[model samples]
Target: MAKYKAPLRDMRFVLNEVFEADKLWAAMPATQEVTPDLVDAILEEGAKVTENELFPLNRTGDEEGCQFSDGDVTTPAGFKDAYNLMAESGWMGLGGNPEMGGQGMPKMLTVLFEEMLYSANASFALYPALNSGAALCLDNHADEAMKEQLLPAMYEGRWLGTMCLTEPHSGTDLGLIRTKAEPNADGSYKVSGTKIFITGGEHDLCDNIIHLVLAKLPDAPAGSRGISLFMVPKFLINEDGSLGERNPAFCGSIEHKMGIKGSATCVMNFDGAQGWMIGEPNKGLACMFTMMNYERLSIGIQGLGLGEVAYQSAMDFAQERIQSRAPGGAKYPEKAADNILVHPDVRRMALNVRAFNEAGRAFASYVAMQLDTSKYHEDEATRKKAAALVALLTPVAKSYLTDRGLDCTITAQQIYGGQGYIREWGAEQYVRDARIAQIYEGTNGIQALDLMGRKVVSNNGEYLKLFAQDIQDFIESNSDNAAVQPYLEKLGASLETLMQVTGNVITRAKDNPAEVGAASQNYLDLFGLVTYAYLWARMVAVAAPKAEADTSGFYSAKVKVANYFFARILPEAAALAAQVNAGADTLMDLEEELFYGE
Candidate 1:
């Protein structure tokens, strides 16, 4: 595979030009200190660390995987050293709260840096990614005493964090979780149960691991309502902030997975581990969502990052690897045959990947900007509006980006033909690594259901309407600009289609609950398509005028990609709409036994 290079230029385009993130940052009091120069410096430094330190370890880390012996877990060679460097450089707390020893960067800035980390080494990225989510959860929900006790070391990276929600029998359904937390003479509880598929559950990269686990009290009610969140440390901490006796949480084993081999996926057994409750009793899932929602977006970036590297690597291959002559006839007659890129189909595949990656970057930044607004905006009403939009789009970001991510990786791998299958080329590793993003952080299917069932239908599409208005407002403001008129018209139509389908589903669901589930995935696809159309239109608006005067092909390429997205990709919305309107009858008609197929 080609050497991984951070897409700093494209990142800048998304943050500075497309989103005008600096202006937004300046307007918010919390982000007022974040100037354009500081953001640029952060981006440059982030690119260097991810490219120089993390990229070198990716192949070797995947090759080495993680080691497990007895109760201890060991990460791939060089991982500990790299983690230490990130920690010492204060990179771990790049987005943590300022009062908690963090650098207090906005989500808009951190998401771009996260993309670099995932692009360079997804396996290694999991360690810090999980830490950030866990830290966010603690900062948001835990009281001041707990924050003082935990946030400092966690932000400093001396102690890392993990979210333990799934078990062998229960994955998505929190109500069925059998983990039991018994109250002690002291305020703490004894958390005892086995949790599986715990990422960073037990790794050698940090001095201690803080697990935000879900459990139930003996007298609690049944189902999800009874669940409570707890903070279980691998090694207990003394009152003076020094290390104390070892906690009962132990790594029973680690899974040998298809990809992300460098990241340890462990089976953890909390054998009467001393854990403190994070929030009110039976409100665990609500508190844990603070982290889950964070992970959902991070997982989306996992897909975006992998898709980007895959595209670049495939393009690199296309430059050197010659195959048949071009369809128009030998473009490179000086060589034995034209490069594979001369083939229209190859270009199609490359363009497909590029369109999604660029749009995904913009989409992620859009969501991050909402997160910033929800958190830092002084006006209560504005914060509520931004928070609602964040909730509405979080699922789309997680599901759509990942779904396209897997497709992009496969397409990139196909560019290599037989060479792509070989492990040495590195394309196959990307495909393997990208696969899990869709499955974890609430599977794409679940995300769609959440979008259709909860975020949209639960409120009668109020949140979605709020989002639609934002796009509609943009279209109205730019209706007169001839250069962007075509894009605005198309975007307006797509927005109309999305609103129609959404209203149809909401009406249909009143009679048949199954309609929501049946329409969910397709509805999500339609929503995602329209959302990308809006972003592409905005990108074109910014790049159209600059393309004519710019010496670099950046603006021109951006315009071309936007055109491709509108002309070629946006049409998929129609097909998704049709599928969403197909109703649940066809799906529910088959008998349960028929599905088994005698």
Candidate 2:
């Protein structure tokens, strides 16, 4: 396996330089206490933990997988100690509410650390990732007493958290779930159901496992309207804040999976498990959505982190593995043959991965910045605008990042040739791990539909206009910068194309609802491509001037990647535009019965 190293320089460049996160932090009251030195220390220590602790366990965990006997699940060796180290260091609650025991770090900084965790060991990362999501849900919906009791222990790492939503019969359709929640004599309720694919469902790493489960009450209406969220713990908590006897919830079995083997995906049986209602009755879906949104972004980061690791490993291999001589001449004449880096095809693969990874980093940071603004901005109008932007881009961030992440991982694996397929190199693991990101968190297709249906069509293109206007504003501001003029023009053209496509989709959907579904995936891709273009332009605007004056080549590399993205990658927006414009005729004309002939 290739040794994992955190990409701190690129991360710092995105955080401190590209986004000017420090300035944003200083301006926000919530983040004013987050000093530059504190951010640096967090990143440095996070890097050490991921590289030294988690990376060592990644391959071994994959090989060993998890062991389940009876209702208990045991994680792979080294996971317990590493998890403890992470929790003891307060990494689990980096973004938790400060009023609780959390460090209260901003998402902009925590996101960088999250990428490192995902890069080091995706399986190990899932544990804390789920905890963070659960914590966010509780912070938002749980009552003060519930918060006072649960948040502190979870933030302090004495407990871990899980989100239990998926059941055997239902995946994307939460309304189809069969979990049952019944009121007891006390205020607490009894939750009973079988939930599958529950990550960290029954792990042994912490003292207690808190499950934020979704179920329906007896008096509730049918379908999604009836669902309610509950907080079910593995060990019932006493009023004195101490652990009591084990609850009825048990892991019937653990799954055997393609990747992330160290993370226990289990079949949890909540046999009349004692649980407390989180929000109001029959509002469980809404409560769970708060966590789902958080998880969706986190899962997207899972792809980004794995992609970075794959790129690093591939780049390292290309520099050392000698193959056929260069097309022009032998670059390493003294050696038997030139390195693979001398080939255009090899460079193409590397650059493609680099382009996507770097853009993904920027895009994630942008979303994080919006999250910070929405939460901390003093002006109500500013907060509403930030919140709108977050809603508009959350689906894009989740779908586009994961889609490109999977592509980058595959390209990176191809760089290894036959060696990439082998387990020793760890290239294939990246591919396997990345595949889930696309499928889970409502799938890329679902994200596309949501983007088109709810965010765009339902709003009558209001959110789309807001995003386009932001891009136009940036283009106008940089119109005179000779260094970024070409980029500005390309971005401007793409933004116009996106606007036209959005209007077309809205008009067509009015006549035929299927048109929305047909154009969704392609339309989402177009939006994503243009968004990346805008970000690349911003990055180039920052780096190009510095590159021209310096010989260090750091800023020059940024310009090169930006150029490659515009020249090679951004043109895909045109093809996507063509596809979306093709309409739903071809898709709908094909009879459903023909899909599977008798």
Distance from true location, Cα of 597 in model 2, Å = 3.5
Residue 504 of model 1, lDDT score: 93
lDDT of 2 by residue, 1-598 (tens): 4757898888888898888998998988989999989988999999999999999898999999999988789999999999899888888889999999898999999899999999999999999999999999999999999999999999988898999999999999899999999999999999999999999999889999999999999888989999999999999999999999989999999988888899999999999999999999999999999999989899989999999999999988888899999999988899999999999999899999999999999999999999999999888998898899999999999999999999999999999999999999999999998988998878999999999999999999998888888889888888889999999999999999999998998999999999999999999999999999999998999899889786878899999999999998999999999999999999999778889958
lDDT of 1 by residue, 176-282 (tens): 99999999999999999999999999989989999999999998899999999999999999999999999999999999999999999999999999999998999
Native-referenced Cα lDDT, model 1: 0.94
Q: Give the TM-score of candidate 2.
A: 0.99
* Cα RMSD, each candidate: 0.8, 0.9
| CA displacement after TM-score superposition, residue 49 of candidate 2 (Å) | 0.7
Per-residue error at 266 for model 2, in Å?
A: 0.9
Relative to the true structure, how large is the alpha-carbon lDDT of every model? Answer: 0.94, 0.92
Candidate 2 yields a Cα-based lDDT of 0.92
Instruction: Please state the error at residue 172 of candidate 2 in Å.
Output: 1.3
